[model samples]
Target chain A: MDVDICGPSIPTILGIASEQVHASSTGWSPIYVQDNFGVMSVGFMLPSSRDAIMWRGPKKNGLISQFLKDVDWGDLDYLLIDTPPGTSDEHLSIVQYLKESGIDGAVVITTPQEVALQDVRREIDFCRKVGIRVLGIVENMSGFVCPNCKNESQIFKPSTGGAKRLAEETGLEFLGAVPLDPRIGKSADFGVSFLDEYPDSPATTAYLDIIDRIKQLVD
Target chain B: MDVDICGPSIPTILGIASEQVHASSTGWSPIYVQDNFGVMSVGFMLPSSRDAIMWRGPKKNGLISQFLKDVDWGDLDYLLIDTPPGTSDEHLSIVQYLKESGIDGAVVITTPQEVALQDVRREIDFCRKVGIRVLGIVENMSGFVCPNCKNESQIFKPSTGGAKRLAEETGLEFLGAVPLDPRIGKSADFGVSFLDEYPDSPATTAYLDIIDRIKQLVD
Candidate 1:
């Protein structure tokens, strides 16, 4: 479920932005891409993609609460809540709403830069204070292999050792690092799985490895 | 004013994270970077850099309102409000609160990618609906010049002609593009001015040009 209410890009990234949520006797049905894989986002309810959701914290919290209560998410192994950066209203709302239900842990994603790592550190602290476990840290845009020269460039130079060092310091597992691949963003924009399209890419390999680790930790 | 309550970073970026806001008879004093320039952020109020501010929208809005009223901003030529991404509470609160005071416009900063551009487009739509003028768009991380080969690479590849095309498509001014210079982030993290640190760099040149354009537009 895409809980990033302000900018719900899950629909866009999942190639389901055009789909809408259908309400029935059961409840609001999640638009399924596959028989088992289903998704829900405020993006589906938008009159238009360009329309801004000019909602305040309380109203946003209401929608999120309603989303959990109303969405007919059937037979789910795990309900991952994708949030935007920062530990604000949406993050608080989800945690509070799910306190009884319980959140397994949070997987922190950060760019290979001190600036972003700083935020991730704060997020980890937030997880601790809120009693949520941090599964691990995943470094993204760790390095970019120049398509022309094949020389890897630390595009977002991790001034402070990036997520690996961060995880080590925090005593958490370092999931993996995904190299900078422009095609990954393109695939996301087109709503296609990068893993499926670029099966042999380093980024895909890294993502798969990270996915495996997360599965082992959670499952 | 740094209105990103959950993650106020203006202090860290300005290299003044160690300083605290001194409240006296005149109200809160903004930490000065120079003789003329001063900044205020919630970072200064933090007990520590690693602490997370888990505030909801209403509480954040209240603090923002208090900041505006309590801060001893004396005489100001222009009060710039730096906001986080998304068209949510903080965005709406600022617009609503400033509607009576009259806001000049918004300076939208974005990266050279469709994903970021999509958000910029939504933000512009938000500006229109909120009756705020979009001064222009400034694209950051447009390209990276490899240090070894000195060959330019569109690191965050402009899959759709970057922000220049988006500006043209939306009938907004394209201020400039700041090439990816990792030093820029380093400088910000350390609270030093990248322009001053690397006076001869192309990123500095782009920033100076963009600053000039923004000054002309805003003034």
Candidate 2:
């Protein structure tokens, strides 16, 4: 089934189509593009094997910008830029360059905690000042559920609906929370998305809803 | 043949004795330490199969201090430190830490060029400020032997005896010159000191003379 789309639907369709293409290229048939406007990722351009280049500062920034400008994006509806850790040169270069190249918006990911949340707020402020629309916030690692009691325990204490409060305080939409799951970490470690690995998992369900919200916001 | 003696030559004696111990530990015993006092190096602690943890900045500084403080000196004489490129944190941390730890002076390494020679003067100035004795300078990569003509070419374009010029300018002893040799790089690559690999080479002879001069300084 071949379908063409534009606008906010572009990122989702491109993500699905890219994954199917990648899977099929590795001689894996029966891989189909599903979810017309739902998926989001930055794994499409990564090498299948270990030829990963490691360098310091300016070198890393140069490589990332080269990827964005030179790589064939192939008609993206909404290009999502997944960033590396830390507020460093690479992060600064990517955010500013992407804005210049004209991105629809950005989804800021943060674990629920005072430390990280504070950093996230600064990043959001920076984005706004630079004229980039931040879609919303995704508060990951919100809480962990005890298997025996089925009661939720906050792993990073001093965090409960803080994302919501911040969103409300800042006049931005609150995208809810994602529970802490060991499986999510494991899936990422194995270079597969958690949603792709365990579609019915609680975390995946949360991500699906977030995607739906994004669709509504863009439409 | 194992020989051990103590005094101002403790680092040098330790270095010499370690050659025997390192030889005994490994079946092939080509590694020997000749104390060229004041010459800074991280090569002494490197095991046969590992690359020296050469990096830039505070981390590298920390590692140098650790190597000095933690490593077993045993019944050795002189401990020479081969510093990394420049007159910054790596060099400062090394000299200062060694002085604080009650170690001897520093041997500044430079080539016969105005640019490098100028930096060497600053390094000497830094050492004087920090109260580390200035032993002298070992001019390295001074010249190259022409492959076809067999005539030495000043490949590095040495400014007509840089060591002598620096010695006069800074009023410090000018040790000697180490001619530019491809074998030095080759030996370093193979984790063998150039002197150990090519003991009879002119470069090795220069190192031996430098060692003798170092012995005189320490004694």
By DockQ, the best candidate is 1
lDDT of candidate 2 at residue B22, scale 0 to 100: 32
lDDT tens digits by residue: candidate 1, A1-219: 888887888887788879988999879999998898988888889888878888888888898998899999998998888998999888999999998989889999999877788788899999999999999999998898877777788877788888999999999989999999888878777788999999999999999999999999989
Cα deviation at A153, candidate 1, in Å, is 1.5
Query: Reference contacts recovered by each candidate, as fractions?
Result: 0.59, 0.00
- Tens-digit per-residue lDDT, B37-123, candidate 2: 222223333342112132324455555565555444444565555543334444556556756566466788876655355446656
Q: Write down the worst ten-residue block by lDDT for model 2 chain A.
A: A1-10
Candidate 2 residues lying further than 4 Å off, grouped into runs, are: A1-54, A159-161, B1-219
lDDT per residue as tens, model 2, A70-107: 44444556655555333334456666567656767767
Give the per-residue lDDT of model 1 (tens digit) for B125-165. 99999999999999999888877777788877677888999
Instruction: Estimate how well candidate 1 is docked, as a DockQ score.
Output: 0.69
Error of 2 at A65 (Å): 2.4
Displacement of the residue B120 alpha carbon in candidate 2, Å: 37
- Each model's lDDT: 0.88, 0.53
